[model samples]
Target: MAKGVWIVAEQRDGALRKVSLELASTARKLADQLGDEVSAVLLGSGVEAMAAELGKYGVDKVYLADNPAFEPYTTDAYAQAITKVVKENDPAVLLLAASAQGKDLAARLVGSLATGMASDCTDVKIVDGKLYCTRPMYAGKCYGEVVVDSFPQMASLRPNVFPLVENAKAGAVVKFEPALGELKTKVVEIQKEASGKIDVTEANIIVSGGRGMKGPENYVILEELAALLGGAVGASRAAVDAGWRPQSDQVGQTGKVVSPNLYIACGISGAIQHLAGMSSSKYIVAINKDPEAPIFQRADYGVVDDLFKVVPALTAEVKKLL
Candidate 1:
């Protein structure tokens, strides 16, 4: 029979990602309800030392697969390693973050492991001794609930969707090694962009702009404000499609979904697609000249003034304060 709850604790450069801790906290809550232990799998070259950090987030065991082969996050190598762990442990559930890596790993793992998998889940609940997960469907037009009908039920929770609860425990580090064969594909070079910029999905504050900015050059004002607030800059589909911003900066149904503490929409019309992505934000501030703009309806703070004027003023005031 499947036993403990397992989570794939993702890491980059030997540092655990925030979503991994979020997954551990969710697992901790689920384990409490199911009367099982919360365990985590950490796979990286020198990530064994970070197991203790997972303990603070309520992980009880850290299955360490520290090897040089797992350094660059090759798809097949990770899939092989995780599948081996699941075969040995027979966990009741396997959770992963809905990140680029997590998405790839989870899909490949499920294909080989024969488990029902849900992606981009916002909530996981224990319903009548079953793992029930909620995720957006139909392009976020609505939500759907799912229950995995197999052991080692799998789900990838969206980043920032779950709160990171500080429930300290003994995350006993258990060393394990898997014979990861020669990877068919290998990463040669990784060129990270805007190295200091926080990930849009992971940022606590995000400043997003749309077509109302007139052109790409006007985005400077938004960037200035974002820099002042130490936040990431995001763009709507309209801005991205117009070639004003890179596709990576898009925030919408076809883009990265974010649930930041503060989301500032500049010149964005609050289209359904845009709202579908960031409606979960704790607080929304909208700045648009059009009074009838749909964004005003959802914003906690609305400014019916041209962003050209308001944004510069806001940035100047912020700069003064800083």
Candidate 2:
């Protein structure tokens, strides 16, 4: 029988991502409930030092695959390494982040391991020693619970939805060497964002714009406010479609799903597609000229006014508080 809870920990540029710690902490809770140990599969070059960090979050063991080929993250290389580990030590439940990389890898693992998986889960709990995952359905209109009956139930959790906890453990390391007989894909170049902007999915606060923004230049105001609040600027699908912002900044069903602590929607009419992405925000504030805008219905606070005037005033108030 599968006995231990496992997580595929993610790291980038030699530092562990916040989602990895979230996965570790969540796995710790589930493992304790099941009376099992929590283990993590860490794959990257020069990432052996990160094992101690995972241990601080209640992971008892780290299966280290320290190989240069693991860096730059090719789907083929990671799938081979992770599949080998899971096959060697069968885990009861496997948890991963719902980020771009996690989603890609989890899909491949499901095919290779022949197990069931829940994608982009917002919540997960162990009921009767089984994993029950909660995920949004039909553009956030409803939620459904998922259970994978197969051994080593897999789930990819959404980023920032789960809390991080520190529970120290032994953090023992077990080195594993994967026989990767690969020759399929190669990382030629990686183009990174020049502005070092925060991803909306992982941000605590988001100040977003839409058609009311008028033009891309007006986004500077939102950026100023976001900088002051240590948040990020997001755009609606309309803004992205109009070329006012990059697709990466878009928040909607066709774009990225965000669950920030606070979401400030400016000038956006709140189309169902857009609402489907960010409706799960803890607090939503909508500023629009039209009082009947659909976004007002979902916003916790609604301001019936022009966003051009409202955003500047709001920025001033934030500056005063700072």
Candidate 3:
């Protein structure tokens, strides 16, 4: 039988990613409910130091697999290592963050283990020793609560959906030696986005724009607001599909899901798809001319005025404070 809650902590260039720590905090919540310990699996070339960091998030065990081949994020290699760890540990629940790398790794792990996987989950709860996962379906038109009957209920959590908590634990590090076969695919090229900004999913504040911005030329307003707040910029699918924003900046069912503390929606009409991505935000502020816009329904604060006039006013207020 499965025993504890396990988080697959992802790392790059020998450092743990923020989403991994977020998952650890999330796993701690589930672990508390199930009366299970929270353990983490970290695989990278030189990441033994990250175990202590994981421990701060309530991880009692840090399973370390250090190897050079694991640094570049080969799907097959990560799957092999993760599968081996899961099989050996036999966890009751396995949680992963729904980042680009995480989704890829989780999909392969689910296929390799033949275990049930609930992807892009916004919330997790334990009822009667079972895991109830809340995930969006049909482009966020509706939500589905799933209960996995598999021995290890594997799930990928949407980034920033859960608040991060730092609980101290004297986690013991365990070393593992997996016989990783030759990877079929090798990542030879790497192109990094040139934004000195934080990862949108990890940002506490997100300023998002939509079609109401009118054109790509008007995006500077949104960017200015985001810059003043030191937060990341997000875009609705409408703006992304219109080529005004990159897909990476998209926040919706077909895009990345976020749960920042403050989500400021500027000129965005709240579509169900867009709402699903950001409804989990702690506080939502909507600025739109249409008073009856659906975005107001989920917004904690709303402004019924033209964005051109309102955004500048808001920006001025922010600049004065700065």
Candidate 4:
């Protein structure tokens, strides 16, 4: 029988990502409820030091697979490595973040293990000794509970939705060698965003714009406000389609899903596609000239005015507060 809770912890450049901690913390909660130990898989070059960090978040053991091939994160290499560790341990529950990398890895792992998986889950809990996952459906119109019947029930949780808690444990390290036979893929190069820019999915607060932004140059105001709040700037599909923002900054069903503590939508009419990406935010504020804009229906707070004027005034007020 499968036992214990397992998480595939994600790291970049030898540093653990915030989602990794969230996964560990969530696994800890589920493991405690099931009276099982929590173990984490850390794959990266020279990431042994990160094992202790996972321990701080309640992981009892860290399965370290340190190799040069794991640094760049090829799907094949990681899939093989994680599948090996999971097969060896036979964990009852497996959790991963729903971020881009996690989603990619989970898809491959599910195929490799021939197990069922729940994707983009907002909440997970132990239900009658089985893993129950809650996920949004039909573009956030409704939610559905999922239960995987296969061994090592798997779920991918949305990043930033789960809380990070510190519950220190032994954090024992168990080194393992991955049998990755001749790989089919290789990383040639990686283009990254400008230094200090945060991904919208990981931001605690987001100031997003849409077609109301007018043009790319007008994003300066949004950027100022976002910088003031120590948050990231996001764009709706309209904004990205209009070439006002990069694809990475787009937030919607066709873009990136974000669940920040606060989401401020500027000049956005609140299309269903856009709502699907950020409807999970704790609080939503919408700014639009039309009172009947679709976005106002979902916003916790609505401002019926031109975003151009509203954004500048809001930025000034924020500056004063700081």
Best model per lDDT? 4
Report how far off residue 313 is in candidate 1 (Å): 2.5
Ranking by TM-score: 4, 2, 1, 3
**lDDT score, candidate 2, position 27:** 97
- RMSD in Å for all candidates: 1.4, 1.1, 1.8, 0.9
Per-residue lDDT for 290 in model 1? 93
Task: Name the regions of candidate 4 deviating beyond 4 angstroms.
Answer: none
Candidate 2 wrong stretches, greater than 4 Å: none
Candidate lDDT values, in order: 0.91, 0.93, 0.88, 0.94
Q: Model 3's lDDT to the true fold?
A: 0.88
Clashes of each: 0, 0, 0, 0
Among all windows of ten consecutive residues in candidate 4, which has the lowest summed lDDT? Answer: 6-15
Which candidate would rank higher by lDDT, 2 or 3?
A: 2
TM-score of 1: 0.96
TM-scores of the candidates in the order shown: 0.96, 0.97, 0.94, 0.98
**lDDT per residue as tens, model 3, 223-262:** 8988899889999999999999998899987887888999
Put down candidate 2 lDDT per residue, 1-322, tens digits, no spaces: 8889999999987799999999999999999999999999999999989999999999999999888899889889999999989988999999999888999999999998899999999999999989999999998888999999997899999888889999999789999999998649999999887666888887999999999999999999999999998999999988999999999999988999888999999999999999988998999999999999999999999999988899899999988998
Return the clash pairs for model 4, or none.
none
Q: Candidate 1 on 213-252: residue-level lDDT in tens? A: 9999999999899999999999999999999999988998
> Once model 1 is optimally superposed onto the true structure by TM-score, how far is the C-alpha of residue 146 displaced, in angstroms?
1.1
Output the better candidate (1/3) by TM-score: 1
